[model samples]
Target chain A: MGSATPVDDEAALIAQLRAGDESAYEQVVRTYGGRLLAVTRRIVGSEEDARDIVQDAFLNAFKSVGRFEGNSKLSTWLHRIAVNAALMKLRTRKRKPEQSIETMLPSFLEDGHHEERFKSWDEPVDKALERAETRQLVRAKIDELPDGYRTVLVLRDIEGLDTEETAKMLGLSVNATKIRLHRARQALRTMLAPHFAASGGGKATP
Target chain B: MKCRELADFLMDYVSGELPEEHRAHFELHLSRCRNCHEYLAQYESTVKAGRIACGEMSDELPGDVPEDLVKAVLAARKLDPAK
Candidate 1:
């Protein structure tokens, strides 16, 4: 709970929010809008669309505030709504030919050995990602995943939703969610290997 | 567990979902096998790096989110009756 408000205070705020206090609405937006929009932007990959999704999410939350159980943090609840809104937009969009993940997966030989050698990236990944450029690269590689796998990974790994919640959101079975998430991480690792395995540690000059 | 078997169990191992016996086997394999250990570390790194990137992305709010989002959402709120 990164929220500054005490639990009782948040409960009161939720009451006010449900009662249609305009100020409460503004307060909710001011507090959670940026974070929600950022999540939607990652899922939808567009600022305008992300803004629209956040708007829809807030409107949905406002309309449904009575149902907000307070079992979770308000920010997390809002984050879920935003993720739903983004997924809705994704569903309604025109279909593109789906990208195959085969290219991104690692190749294995007939004898069950890796087709290529993997160099040890003994450096801590958190340290490597701390570099602004490496973080950008990480994001780009995640985006390269196919939508199904990418969404699963984003929800399960990045958004920190449990496998069950992710499966529920994606209309997938728990086993399917697990498989998709594993494949997504493996593919992402393949994409990141060159940069991390390089002796230079992907350090940015600037 | 062999390396190929360990590959299939990687997710379970990392997520702590593997059964105790399987986990022991997986750990034992990692202890002796350099390749599997490196692979496991990189797999963990992929997840760690992904989470970090997403956390950074969440901190990055585009320009429209502050004032415009609030205004638009409030307007929507006004039109709909609160439940």
Candidate 2:
């Protein structure tokens, strides 16, 4: 299954699979299973859950394959299913409302870590490495971003969709997407700054 | 436009979404302002870091995904109505 090649002719495969070719179905599964699993894991943040979600996506895709128009690529159609499945799972979970920034700001100021780090700066190269490491420091920061910011970052940055495509996918105006993306980048920058400074590559400015 | 205004628009500038006149105006401000240049660099790095973080995060699946899970997905497809 791991080494299965992408179907050379997705339309042909879909046509065959629609004609009751079980091998074509298997081929589709083998080609897309790992990637779909990866997308699911990113959204659900659990291997078991991701597996279930991906399986559900495949099942849904199979059930609806005959109705699929050739308007979108087969992979895109499959990924849309995966995204929908992931979003449905995410919806089932309860999430606490975000605290107001005014309430949270004082606690951040009171923290010695923030105070000490913001007091100083670092050289540029060290800053870059530190920024890189911040990716591992918290797994859920992206998930915690405001919904508008999170959606843009996830679609454009994480999912590797371009602005135009992301705009279309999210049903947002391009200007709205740009604003969200800018704010998301800024928010993530603020979160990672201390780590970046500590990594010693950021050039200290007066 | 002031450097402060241009700084706020830096991301759009880098993304090439700014109108030609605005792009020209922003660059004109950038050329003369050291602080804005540095700020722009930091902003660029921040965006780059965000992109890298996303890529790294996506690549890092829990190392212990059970082989059976994939098999189960494959097995489910056998009963697929479309198949």
Index of the highest-TM-score prediction: 1
- Once fitted onto the true fold, the runs of candidate 1 whose alpha carbons sit more than 4 angstroms away are A1-8, A199-206, B56-64, B81-83
Structural RMSD, model 1: 4.9
Tell me the lDDT of model 1 at A76.
90
CAPRI quality level assigned to candidate 1 from its DockQ score: medium
lDDT by residue for model 2 (B42-68), tens: 566666665555553333432323457
* Tens digits of lDDT, candidate 2, A1-206: 23346578888898887786777766676676766776676666677888888788878887888899999888788888887777667767775674332221211122111221232235553244455345555335665666556667777766677888878766789888887787776675556556555653232232
Number of the top-ranking candidate, with lDDT as the measure = 1
- Per-residue lDDT of B62 in model 1: 26
* Model 1, span B4-40: residue lDDT tens: 7888899998988899989999899889977778788
Model 1 chain A poorest ten-residue lDDT run:
A197-206
Interface RMSD of 2: 6.5
